[model samples]
Target: MINKQYSITQAPNYWYDIMRGVEQGYSIKLTRNSEVVAMLVPAQYEQPPKQNFWQALEIFRQQVNIAELYDENVFSDVRDRCPGREVLL
Candidate 1:
């Protein structure tokens, strides 16, 4: 490969070609005012999946709310045993 500097154009076709080069073997650096800001790595390193605060909350939300809180068979029996009380589940 030649030591020719390349410019990242704002064209879709050019972007596609750049992505292909990146996939093959290329270094893409995002600079702001000639200062390096970020980059698109040629390949991603192996890392554990990340879970943000909301994502962790969502994962916890999917867990069972209560074991016998709303069991259909036991619900009616519990209701009969305790009447005039609000069944909030």
Candidate 2:
């Protein structure tokens, strides 16, 4: 990939030119006072590997042990039974 540098001040004037360069797989370095502030490059769109519902569930089950995660004794007293403060109308 070709790399080109342009000052921040020149960006507004050469906006389309810079975008065109990026579209053509060129990397554009935007600089301010000779220091690079940002880069413009071609966007890469990657689709995640698709999984069926059953396959996904299997993977989840392997990672999480349901027996240890949902012990009834551990969850029995999780919530307070007391009613909250009553508001006066």
TM-score, each model?
0.33, 0.49
lDDT of 1 by residue, 1-89 (tens): 32112343332446776677678766666445555565555664346689999998888778757554665675565454545777789
lDDT of each: 0.58, 0.88
How many residue pairs clash (N, CA or C atoms closer than 3 angstroms) in each of the candidate models, in the order given? 0, 0
Worst 10 residues of 2 by lDDT: 40-49
List pairs with backbone clashes in candidate 1: none
Q: Give the TM-score of candidate 2.
A: 0.49
Where model 1 places Cα greater than 4 Å from the true spot, the runs are 1-13, 47-89
RMSD to native, candidate 1: 13.7
Best by lDDT: 2
Model 2: colliding residue pairs: none
lDDT of 2 by residue, 1-89 (tens): 64898999999999999999988888899999999999887875245688999999999999999887876787669988889999999
Most TM-score-accurate candidate: 2
How far does residue 89 in candidate 1 sit from its true spot (Å)?
95
